[model samples]
Target: MEGGKRGDEAGPSSEKLGELSEKLNEVCHVGEDEEDEDEDHRSNGVAAGFVPGPLVSLKEQIEKDKDDDSLRRWKQKLLGCLESDSDGQMEPEVKFHSISIVSDDFGEINTPLPVDENQIGRVLFTLKEGSEYRLKLTFSVLHNIVSGLTYSNTVWKGGLQVDQSKGMLGTFAPNREPYEHTLEEETTPSGVLARGLYSARLKFEDDDKRCYMELKYSFEIKRQS
Candidate 1:
């Protein structure tokens, strides 16, 4: 009771107690912050507000983050046909007209012509086994590829009969009227445009074993597809 009554008169000791209390409060606050920091590190592998590790400048990283493979781009193809003649000893430039595109087993419009029904000559086309595509293709052209091959003596007196297997002598022979082709002003496709391909072929009889009636084409089907 006596000490409590004198406490009011003794002010220096009270001030010391207050200073000690302030120090203790500061220490408690520091301890709590350290515990919070440790808890944050355990949960997130980093201090809540602290930035860890060295800061990296973007200039040092530069273009390294981009993929190198992204540089390639899609490209389109050109389609059409041109012909050359090789009957005689010297090769001759052939002119072609009435080009056509044919297909078989066309399951869809956007896909390539089926294997069996792929690009070939003749309106009569064959489809592959289990093929769901359409057949028969034709296109217009100004002239035949081997234009000069149908000169005077080439036609028989008995009227021209084209050997379908040999392109020139067959129905398309120049002297034959039944299968004669008329020149069209357009280089555009007229008959079949399966998917998106165009084709033209030339057949001819040759004494040279090295050459046979062959296919000539420059049709563009979407290769990117």
Candidate 2:
């Protein structure tokens, strides 16, 4: 009779223990799934922080193309300046950095002045054909001023007028803002190009042609070279 009672008690205890084991397994499975989701979320966050290699390459390529385009346009402008004008009557208004007149062959005015009255006599002074003895006149636009405006500058050398302009700006227009002008012309001692004390009378004029802000500058014309 004791053995029968003990068997009944064992059957109830075994059933309770099996139920507890199943509950513990379910809890462990749920915890493992949650941990896997957290790990996946961390991997996704890391990927989002990094830019793709292809996208970075594309951005670099775009910048290079833009730089190339700018360089090409600049080259075109320089080539155009060296070419003759389409009308064949206008002077090529080249860009310069400073204001001075110098000879290509004899060097600058400070070297040694050319003594020949008809220096390089064989080479005639003609705008159509170039000459070895050339005058490079460089000047820049004054700051705080706009284009399409005329500035007066009367230049005298050897008591003869070299530059007498009612509108010194002429028909030339600036290629860009803060432009400088370089005038390269075949020169001779004849007319007003003879060497002497050079003087210039510069003035800015109003719309009514009234001159103001008058300035005078003088430079020696003797080049020893």
| Deviating ranges (above 4 Å) for candidate 1 | 1-95, 103-203, 207-225
TM-score of 1: 0.17
TM-score of 2: 0.29
Worst lDDT run of 10 residues, candidate 1, spans: 71-80
TM-scores for every predicted model: 0.17, 0.29
lDDT of each: 0.24, 0.34
| Candidate 2 Cα outliers beyond 4 Å, as residue runs | 1-98, 106-147, 157-163, 166-177, 184-188, 191-195, 204-215, 222-225
Report clash pairs, candidate 2.
111-224, 111-225, 112-223, 112-224, 112-225, 113-223, 113-224
Model 2: lowest-lDDT 10 consecutive positions: 23-32
Across 101-187, the per-residue lDDT of candidate 1 in tens digits comes to 334333322212222335443232323322232212222212222121211111111233211111222112111122323221122
* Global local distance difference test of model 2: 0.34
